[model samples]
Target: MNPMIRSTRLALAALLLTALAGCGDKTSPQTASSRAPSLSTVVVKPETAHREQVWDGVVEAVNEVTLTAQTNARVLELPYDVGDTVAKGDVLVRFTDIEQKSVRRAAQAQIASAQANFRNAEAQYKRIAEVFSKGLVARSDLDQARMQRDAAQAALHAARAQYSEAGQQVDYTVIRAPYAGIITHRYVHVGEAVQAGPPSPQPLIGLESLKDLRVTVQVPQSAVDAIRNHHHAEIMLGDGKRLAASKVIVFPYADPKTHTFNVRLLLDGSHASLYPGMTVKVAFAVGAAQRLLVPVAALWHQGEMTGVYVVQGDSVRLMQVRVGERFGSRVEVVSGLAPNQHVATDPAAAARYLSSERAEPKA
Candidate 1:
């Protein structure tokens, strides 16, 4: 055999062996570090969570009223319309005052006449009493003058009362808001006829205060006793906002039809963007429990899929989780996840890391 041919065969055989070794390395399993890149993560652990009985509640204003017509008049001016905010003592409606003013003036005139008659009767009685004391006039004349003076005094009192009442009637023609609130409804319009009386007075306007708000919940009879004893609750609003109730009120009697008792939760101060007739969830603290909690930001969603990027040693994988009630920034993982397992806190960062890892060439 030639030496050059042997050397060339040996070189070719070494090249083939090297190629086969490279292919075998590609089929081997990847280590933990090679599967996922580094990311900020948190450990899943159990926390003390409050166990609550949640019920649907309706929001209502603490100070709400409907202004009704107190006197017969034609509505001349309506200064406010529905959805208008009003200050205390602001004029809401103004009615024609011609009839009321005329009555007031007549009563004033009557008062003046009554005052003059009473003055004259008093003067006459004094003169008659002095004359009778001096034995210059009969006793009957003195007695009659005294009686006339008393009657005149009584008539003057009646006239004054009538004048005051007439003034009140005139005041009733102009309606004013009793407190600061939003006008929810305007039942009477400008130039509308409003009557006050027997069957039912005409509703003029409706007002509700937004500053002081309360949530009304119809609780079942079984839960009423517990709620009454506890008297602690929180109102759940949109955007994950929770408000604590300042006070709780439970009605003694239950509804005849539903067998539910009325429970009211009064909010402390002004409610942020809360309005009447809004449905909210009220959670009453009943007990406590241990729950596996993870930051809400860790949860990932893709169409119908929901899971978290769980970190195992140096590797991170998406694990589907069954979540229960949400507690502020954290959520309870009911199942599909175990305690002490680390999860990526920043889901976007984890996703990016995973993408980069998958795109890299395998070792």
Candidate 2:
């Protein structure tokens, strides 16, 4: 063979060997066929016996009363404003009582006049009766004197009753707090005329007792039965404070539109800072049976729904699950999941890796 030809062949052979080595290096350990993707998992198991359902609610006063004006008059004075604490029987507001005072004064005058007339008539009647008894007066005359005396006495009693009524009407003009509470609202200011009777009588003030707080929660109709029988509840304040309530009261009927029932949880008196209109979360211990649950990380939220990836053999299967109440770190799985199922902690990475592995041709 020619030496040039032999050199060319050697170069060609060396190039071929190098290409084979590079191919082997690329396909050896890091190839999809050789390496299986690693995935993190969270084991599912039956939750502990203790479980509770948490619901959102708002804090409310135990006793809330709306104070309205009792007499139609211009607001003369408002000693208390919103957020002012007052005691029972405390005069919170006052209306113009000039007319009531005048009426009372007139009644007093009438009573005095009637009393004087009664005394004079009684003295005249006594004299007349004495003369009649001594046979110095006719029977008709005595009868007329007795009638006058009776009429005067009746007039005096009527006047006294009218005076007492007027005094009570005057007292009603001053708006007093029905109970010890904090004034939450004041609608009337000086010179505002308020109607006394109902139908449209604007409440002059709003009062709420702050010593004891309550939470009103709207529970679904399905859970209404459980709440009715429930004896205790837990309340979570807006500030992250947790409290246990001793009693739970459920409304007898469900709302027609929402199909939900109103439930109230009474907080212990120690939680004085909780006031009306504060938002809160309430938890009721409705059921005690055990159920399967997993860490929130194991579940994936997609759009409006949630799902989890179950590890089966070497592949992960997507599962749609219905979730129930969340109990701390773990959430209850109401359906579509079984106990002891291995759920992928990171579903996004697991799915991608699984897809890559399946795409490669098998050996």
In terms of lDDT, the best-performing candidate is 1
**lDDT of candidates 1 onward, in order:** 0.84, 0.77
lDDT of 2 by residue, 1-363 (tens): 899987787677555433322312323221233453477877788865544677888888878988877777898989988989999999998888999999999999999999999999999999999999899989999999999999999999999999999998799788888889899888889999888777766778989987777788998988777766656687765454457786788988889999988998877658865778887778787877788887766776654456777775444556668887555556778897888888878868765765575577767
Off by over 4 Å in 2: 1-50, 135-139, 197-202, 238-241, 289-363
Q: Model 1 RMSD to the real structure? A: 13.1
Global local distance difference test of model 2 = 0.77
Query: What TM-score goes with each of the models?
Result: 0.72, 0.61
Residues 1-363 of candidate 1: C-alpha lDDT, one tens digit per residue: 799987777677555333322312323222224644677889888887677899999999989999999899999999898999999999999999999999999999999999999999999999999999999999999999999999999999999999999999999998999999999999987888899976899999999988899999998998887787778888887777578899999998999999999999999865776789999999987677899988899998754446777777766566667888777788889997988998889988876766566566766
Tell me, by TM-score, which candidate is best. Answer: 1
- Report model 2's TM-score to 2 decimal places: 0.61
